[model samples]
Target: MNHRNPILFEVEKTLYPTVYTLWVYPDLLPAFSTWPPVLQKLAGGADLMLPGVAVPPSGLPGVERGALCAVTLLGNRAPVAVGVATMSTEEMLAAGMKGKGFAVLHTYLDHLWEYGDKSYPPTLAPLVPDPAGKESAGHEEEQEGKEPVTSSSPDPVKHVAISDLSLKETDSCAELMGKEELHESRAAEPAEDASPEEQQEAEDTRTPQEQMDALFNQCFFHALKCKVKKSELPLLTSTFLRSHMFSCCPAGQQLDIKKSSYKKFSKFLQCMQQQKILQVKELNKGVESIVEVDWKHPDIKAFAVPEGFSSASAAQDSKSEDREQVYHAPEIIPLYGVSTKMVPLFQESGHRKGSVLSSSEVRNIIINYVKANELVDETNKNFVKVNPILCDCLLDKSEQDEISHLKWDELLSRCLERLQPLHQVTFFGQEPVVRKGNIEPIDITLAQRSSNKKVTIIKNLELYGLDPQCVANILQQKVQASATISPTPGAKDRVQVQIQGNQIHHLAKMLLEEYQLPRKYIQGLEKAPKLGRKK
Candidate 1:
């Protein structure tokens, strides 16, 4: 048996150089000059101090020298021949640490500072030497074997003062660290105001058209539901029926219908049709329901005709009988209650020639009579002539008293005399020649002048041409005067029916009440009746 195996190999590679950040306070700038030449160049320029520091000559009032300046390196790596210190250039030179001497001390400080107080020499004093003084060989050797000076001392007074100074420096460093950290954190946080994404989401939540469509669909569903529940027949017909039903429902009930949700009435009708609950023939039936029959059909009579008498011929006979009975005896009273009579006035001539008064003619006569009465009062002169026979029949006892007070004879004579010339005068037609002792040639041309007779008459009287207004005036007078009338029986059993002023007023009142209309609405009703059967 042959076996095949896969081969694998391990590989290693060098990593890229990492960058580091360094912080330098104003007091620590002089210490950086002590770094090795290569490291000093890597530190960049002197103007670049740490973020929380002010430059030397402008140092913050309470800041001290030899304070710790932050330096961030890659992982645990430290720069060669460099150390962290906080001191100005003037302070470093005064302490006799400059040039080559400062560079050596800086390297030693880096090594010893890492071990903190443990790396300090056992025997040392906290004091600087004068740069001008020369060192003795024996003293220099003795100092070399002793430990370096530290901020703390064994003496109680010196130790207490040094401890207090250390605490004050620590607090100042902490404050500066806190301010830098706070500034960085604030820069990284997001703005407090709303973002574009949030605004867009709010707008996308519900578009205007979507909201409108939802509202419309809800209303449609509610209307369909109401139609389905109340209808007895299939849904197809229910939609039409619902509209009529909704109108009948009170306004409050309509709101309730809107809130209801149910399947569309049309859907219900489709279901019913599928189930054969209603046939196509039934759907095609006319507006009336199946239980009700057409009343206009000849076979249907008397609302509930006998079952056996449902023939068309029998229904026709029933209808004829019904029509005949409609003419009852009370409606057929003889005109003037006369059976028959002979007229003596027409006996001498083949026919009577006196003009018979038409209804309109009678109305005109009554209107003229009222006008004449009004003019008589205003002008203080008699203007109307009343026939004694007709006056006696028309006036009641009280009306006679009112007429007597009106100076009946003089008023009648004046009115008749003034009207005599007008009665004989024909307008735009034949003019009657008045036989007089000496009269100018009859002015036929003048009499036939081209002018609207009605307009001319109205203008002459200074009155409106509207007939209704005139009629209203006459009616109002009759109401106030309370005129009445009576008629005598004649040989023809026909009495002269003179309508009194009060009777005219009663007719006007009836017209107003019965039709809820003014007299102007029936302007043509007061006319002559033809000699024939009533329409």
Candidate 2:
């Protein structure tokens, strides 16, 4: 808790045995320079706006959304506030640096700082970006390599004291500092002095997919080194991806398995296991778990945390970490498309053939059309008089009884039947996938093999966004039976999982209870062996 000029402190929680914010050095986190006014606003509980951020000649540090960051006033290296980034570096540029940027958590004049000697932040002149701004990329790289030493040197930072300056002089000095910082931020790109071949060699030679794969491996190793504990072995792979690896990913980068050469995350883990970095085992059919991590592996020991990627203070707040992690099953919502016969019926509602609408939306349109046409039966109230649109869509050709009316429930059912059935599947943190035709429910069937051995065959899990292999792993582990997944007959792209013995009950329970899927969306539950009437 040494709070002298450099302000050394540690943030911890009684609930957490270990401190969540681990900064071996005070300047480890990325720092953004701002004006004294912005610091005042931040100390008064205002978020740091992008417009208020004073960028140095080197430009803003690369940081991802949720990364911990610090804020300092112009011409001063001493940070006056600490916060998390509200958006990534690229996002700020994309937005033209207008909206909110950093979410301030602590400030110099706040209660936390009050606990110390209440010392005012010492003035240490900020690094002056080269005025000529003609430094080559190689020189810039070299300077960056020396950034750690320069940043730490500011501690007990030797600089002229500003106490003697009058109010007008101080303001003038701040203005000059602001101009220098802006010039540095807008400095021109360095010239390339290398030959074409040399330039090519200097640039990353890997393909986009290869780079992403390497990033995944880097984040995985980093997570194993700094985040995962030996006691947390047998960690669920899905949890590892969503919680640990994602956090370790560097700023301005994303961790999407689909973008990697190894499309499946499981395959990536398997590759790591092959390389002896970690050991992955299927504790259940379709589900893989990391049972062991090679902490002392040469690669792990040699790994270095990438610059500006501080997950410890940046990933999330302490309260967020304390919350329990929960899995969100994919959401499947039914939608309807206007059919040719119903095109005229829904024309007034601006719905054309092939336009999709939710059930409630369709019902509202239908009700509005019916009421406007005064189609509801005057006497019964439950039946609706058939109009030309309804007659065209609801009646069959063979029903020649000259029926002019239908029950309310019957009319709604006929309306839905006449329209095209569609469904949208949405996974967490992903775009919704809209598909034509009815959603195929997960199918489970019991079949007899050549030796009269009963087995369970499951299909169409992909329709609900479930990975077939992962499901197979879970089922295999649950029943302690051999489970295999292969391409479905005549379908090259789709696959089915087959497990030894009739384990339909387990499969149904997983879908119905754990996944919270609607029973109507699950097919062949009747094939499950009856509890009382044993097979």
Model 1 lDDT, full chain set: 0.26
TM-score of each: 0.12, 0.47
Over 1-535, each residue of candidate 1 has an lDDT whose tens digit, in order, gives 0011000001111110101111101122222221111222222212112211212222222324543222221111122222224444456445433211111112212222222221221211111122222234223322331222123344322222212322233323223332333224223212123243442242234444433332333233223222222212222232222332222232222323223232343443343234333322233222211122223221111112111222422323343223222221111111111011111212222222232322334335444555644533445544443344224534455666556433545443333222212112111111222222221110101012235221000010001111122222333354443221112222121111122221332443434453233333333233322335221
lDDT of 2 by residue, 1-535 (tens): 2221112222221010000111222354677866443454555555677766755435689999988777766544556666778899999878766667776656666555454334344332212223243234224323322322223454412321222223332223223332332223213111112233332232334467756866787788667766666755676676577556765776556788999888998888887787677898877555667899887664565444454445453323333212112224678898999988889889998979899999899889989999999998989999899887677777887653588888888888888988999999776555677899888878888888999999899988766655565567667767899987665776434668899987878888788877777898888888887787433
> What's each prediction's clash count?
11, 14
Error of 1 at 376 (Å): 8.8
Candidate 1, number of clashes: 11
**Stretches > 4 Å off in candidate 1:** 1-359, 365-382, 385-387, 398-402, 405-535
The superposed Cα distance between candidate 2 and the true structure at residue 182, in angstroms, equals 14
